[model samples]
Target: MVECGAKHLIYVSRSAGKSKDDENFLHELQVHGCRTQTFAEDVADSSLIKKVVQNAAKPIAGVIQMSMILKVQGTWNLHNAIPGKDLDFFVLFSSLSGILGQIGQVNYAAANTFLKAFVQYRYSLGLPASVLDISAMADIGYVSNRPSVLAQLRCAGMQMLKEPDVLDALRLAILRSLPTPSAAYETTSTMATGFHSVSNPAHLATAVATDTSILDDEETSGELLAIQIGKQLLTFMLSTESEEELDLGRAPSDMGVDFLVSIEIRNSWRQSFRSEITVLGILNAHSLKDLGKMAAKNLKEKFERRNEAMK
Candidate 1:
């Protein structure tokens, strides 16, 4: 909307603080002839919300609610204060974690789930409500602040949303219109609403499936391939330069592999070998040799289980 020659734009946030990058963002909008003003108010505060609305630019066209607390009651307060239902489009930035509960984040999942349901509720009221259950965004937003968390997410098979795709998705969401026929929007969907993972949409489902093990011998091949996969994963984890000169005898910690790197390895191992090696197991290994042995053990267990089931 900024580039489309919008006359007045009102930005409501908790504070008027601007990082150098944020200032650049506002400047770019102004350069595009979009007169922008920032309002400092807590959206969850009923009085503050009303005050902001009363002081807002005339004819509010849309609302994109992205703020929510990490805990239950606090989140509920914010959700209740979500305004502008009578507007053209209301986009709720939810998360896939709501659908597939994340560890130590029960309150967060519940809160996001509420937002997802709110979209449907608005739809029932004949409002333009869209919920985007987005995954990690690489360069911007909350995920970018903690890159280690992002690495862990990658290990868990979460793909990061690229900037271009995100921009396209946002354009679709806010406009609530059919995608334009352009090279930039070629891959984006016309019906890019409801539940969507910015990266892999089917990933959560795949992770949730019960049929995890490659029970058939033909499917996973055998012990030799499993060993190769283990070695390859360890190589990828510990080596900064190349996988050629892997020090299998050296401990991962000694080789400068940290807890997060070990997580990446564990996730890779799970995906490649269809093994159920915990991150703890990966970290517990004294050396690369020990890690390989753990992987081998997991493979052996799967084979044994499949054989026993057959019997």
Candidate 2:
């Protein structure tokens, strides 16, 4: 933070620095002309936070919250501590596990997810906030120490970001949330990385089959999604043993897709995409093409403020 031109920094934690390394780090910062203070107080305790702010070297200009369980109550306290209007940036360091969910870290994921919702709340109030949903780091963190952990993440197709990559992301987050909100800039942004390891051909190949990010337009995505759904319907109906035999324009009713099959399709869709298409709705679809269009329309209507109706 000091390297990025922050002169005065107040560090609050449950405990203050007690190690020789900690003293040396503080000395290093001081040598670089950075004013710093460390407060040992529970962020959950609102009264203690009051004291920290009351004795501030300067009125708090910004906040960068490095997160976890403390994020839950700590974030709320911080929100209450400093008025949003006064802040230049309120940045949260969250993990990708918050969005994708991790196997053994339910508490951690939930905490990170809370920060995301908190950011949204702040945004609705027209305050500046940004959450960095960082992936597992390859070096300089806990994951780097555990080979088993690293292997698991690799197998799951998660790319481990290096320190430099993380720093770059942090720089952008701070830059993007500065000064004032703009028409083009999302005031409350979620910056994330490691969703894809583009450098690895094997990883790219594994993700490419269902990855829609490669498509720059939603129209193409909708079309592809429709085709994928249609293929699933074909296999469900047992229309033929081959994908080529499935008629795209043939009505579901003509192909003997009864109420039972419609129910199954509806359930399958709900399981996959949280689709709310009713059994009757599926049966009434004029053709396989219409079914896809119906799904597309449903999506647009459900997610968009304004939508085009199917003729």
Candidate 3:
């Protein structure tokens, strides 16, 4: 609407429901030479949705709420929206869950994977418009039910930050972006010093306090693991320059053991912009090998029980 010399634009989302704010939003749009159209039908209903899209003015941009798990259903609805030239942009509100699968949300992961692929495909073909996927982080928003493993990782990561000055870390992230594209950036002050050794807290504390050039023989470890991970991530962005294509051949499960805990820093601008860092952490046990074994045993037992029940 901003492109077509529209001084006013009102978007009526059916998902907005019958709230008074929706009507007020329409009214606000009218003040700027725009109108609102609300559909009283389900977003997933293809037949009725097609009719709604057909009635809308030229250059329609529709927002679809889709999860990563429901691949077939989500993609089908998106595919249906592609028939019209008026459909300028299909905005999909997806989740980081698609990129980093949540433990219990396998179906969500599948759906989001499909959406990411679909968006990339559309981009590849140089379609007149674009398919945009907006993904949300797991840490942000109301996260009352976050898993214990995730909480542990966050705690570990935070503890590492305490050694470094917050301002220095922000400066480092900014310095890291000087050779890349970063629009706006923020980093915790606690990200400067690398992790200390695990054995000696006193040695770690002494290292922080005094200007000791030599390594302590007492064996000390700090939260350097998290900082190393962070620096490596920043380095990857600096190396890739954000031109790396999505590895389409890789399956969701084959991604990595630390799939969910990985952070992605993308350069989203046409020019060299600031680094946009998004973190995804998994809340599983400390040892992946042990966890996998336990999970396998549990699954085998369940299968055996089911077989006995069937007989």
**TM-score, per-candidate, Cα-based:** 0.53, 0.59, 0.39
Please give the CA lDDT of all the candidate structures.
Answer: 0.56, 0.70, 0.37
**Per-residue CA lDDT of candidate 2, range 22-97, in tens?**
7888889999999889897889998888889889999898998874558888888888888778888889989988
User: Higher TM-score: candidate 1 or 2?
Assistant: 2
**Candidate no. 1 TM-score:** 0.53
- Prediction 1 global C-alpha lDDT: 0.56
Clashes of each: 0, 0, 26
**Model 1, residue 55: C-alpha shift (Å):** 0.9
Window of ten residues with lowest summed lDDT in model 1? 185-194
| Candidate 1 lDDT tens digits, 1-311 | 66545688777677643668768888988787787778766665666665666777676676666775622333344335445454766666777787777899988888877776665555555456555666778777777889898889878877677564455455545544112223231212112322333223223213212222221222222222333444555566554544345556666567666677767766767675566777676656676666655554455566567757865
Clashes of 1: 0
As a TM-score, model 3 comes out at 0.39
Candidate 2 error regions (>4 Å): 145-148, 178-188, 197-311
Candidate 3's residue-wise lDDT over 201-258, tens digit each? 2322332222121111111111222222233333444544231332323322233424
Report the C-alpha displacement of residue 68, candidate 1, in angstroms: 4.4
